[model samples]
Target: LTRYDRMMARRRPKKGQAASKGYREAKKWRAKTYAKIARQRQDTGRKWAKKAVTDHDAIAVEDFRPKFLARSSMARKAADAAIGATKKALVEMGRKHGRDIRLVHPAHTTMDCASCGARTKHALPLSERTYTCTACKVVSPRDKNSARVMLVRAGLNPAGVEGVRPPGALLPEAA
Candidate 1:
């Protein structure tokens, strides 16, 4: 799309001149592609949100500010992911199904130790995929630890237990 935009810019008419047929066609194509991608993202977001609502009685998610995140170098990727749209869909699905959808503050959820409730002094960069608690010497996967923290904040597990699920707990057969 960028390449096409550049190509059309050169072919487009100068001041006071009408746009060329090729430029018009390129503009049309760009609009069509943009609409197509928007529709696709909306469809995907709704589908995933519906499935999550169907599978779980309650959903806990971080109340993320995507616009703030998009101001960084990850702007394009964050915009493409459409996190806000997904959240909206999830909330709508939750209301329809009478399921709980809790959006908790995201601060410290990732850096804090889920087991000991201790916050790491130093920031954990994205390159670090595992979280090691300095106080308790407990190690946990980064994403899982954050999820557990969110669940705890939502009061889903008041005991603050970690890794207590039975084997194959999420498997369909276990249901």
Candidate 2:
């Protein structure tokens, strides 16, 4: 991937009357490269999904929309991670295994703290991988904490709601 990035960065516009032909050729080559990389990513995802479905009875993941994130400056790396492809593969594998696959909404999963339900203006930086909850002092991995929040949003377990954990586990006044 680094090599590909360098190649693309070094690419120059073609000069003279044959420039259009050169441009077309370059476009075709880049398309081919993209297709190949996508195929490789899909294949790896299928393998991982197959293993996960075989090992676990139910799989839960966030239903993320990559198109919107792609428009953001800091999300291109995420867009390239093949999360959608992995989810699709997991769903297919779940069907084969007669298991359940769930995707929770992505809204508020990151911003809402899993512990203490404290929703503050602490938007995490993209480079930060750990989640540090200032309200409850419950620190955990960013992805795992986000996943827990997603589960709560999906109503998996009584997450401090009506008849749930004592008040303050959720419903954090947040954006």
Candidate 3:
């Protein structure tokens, strides 16, 4: 896509000049390719969302804009992954199924421990794939811990592999 973008820019006519037939064809091809990729992303997102909503009764998603990723070195990779699109699909699917969907704040998610509910003093770098809590000595994968944090912040169950909440747990009564 980047290569095609460059090619299209080069083929574009100068000021007051008409677009040549070859340039028009190239522009059409680029649009077609981009649309195809978008359709592919939508297809995969819907399928994944369906499976996720079917398997879980509740979901807690990190509420954050993915646009900032475009400024980082992983911009191209992040855009190709289509995380925002997939997340939108997931939320829509969850709503359609009448499942609980919570959007939790993303701050300090990776620094917090799932088991101990403790946060580290400093944020961990991306290279550090594991989270170790000094307060309770609980060690978990960074992504896994962040997921638990989201669940916790969303007031959902943060434990049990089968997505079951602890026995006798109840929601706080509204004031």
Candidate 4:
């Protein structure tokens, strides 16, 4: 898309001027390219959503809203990730399949410790990939910790089918 966008920009016609043949072609190509990308994204999102709803009896969704990201530096990356579309697909699939889908609020999912439920005084920078809880001293990958937080917020045990917790075990969502 970026390549085609640059091509279109270079070929763009001046305001109130007749568009050249090259400019029209480039414009059409850019539109088609973007449309194709969107179609592909939608296809994949639906497929994955179907599989997820089929496999999981209950789901805890982060309920993340990526609209604000449009004005940020991460806009392109977030658009490529299709966070909103995938979420919508998952929810629709779950509803169609009669599965339980929980939408956990996104606030503080990154700063709050999944194990101890302690929030950091300052928000973690995007470059930082590790979450170290000051209160409980538990170190985990930032994404992993956030995922657990979602489960806990949705009242999930954070354990899978093979859940076998020993006495006094530290559960991921115990907090």
Pick by lDDT: which candidate is best? 4
- The 10-residue segment of model 3 with minimum total lDDT is 166-175
Residue-by-residue lDDT tens digits, candidate 2, 1-175: 4444555445645555343554555666778887897898899889999877766565667786667454565357546468888888888889988986788877667877877677758678878888888788888888867767776766665243323333333444641
Candidate 1 TM-score over all chains jointly: 0.76
Candidate 1, residues 30-129, lDDT tens digits: the string is 8887688778878988999988887777789888766555456545664736887788889888999999999988789889887888999988999999
TM-scores of all candidate predictions against the true structure = 0.76, 0.63, 0.80, 0.76
TM-score top scorer: 3
Q: For residue 91, what is the lDDT in candidate 3?
A: 92
- State residue 142's C-alpha deviation in candidate 4, in Å: 3.8
Steric clashes per prediction:
0, 0, 0, 0
Candidate 3 Cα deviation (angstroms), residue 102: 1.1
Candidate 3 lDDT score at position 39: 87
Question: What local distance difference test score does each model get?
Answer: 0.81, 0.70, 0.81, 0.84
Better of 2 and 4 by TM-score: 4
Each prediction's RMSD over C-alphas, in Å, is: 3.9, 9.4, 7.7, 6.4
Clashing pairs in 4: none
lDDT for 23 in candidate 4 is 80
**What ranges in model 3 sit over 4 Å off?**
68-81, 160-175
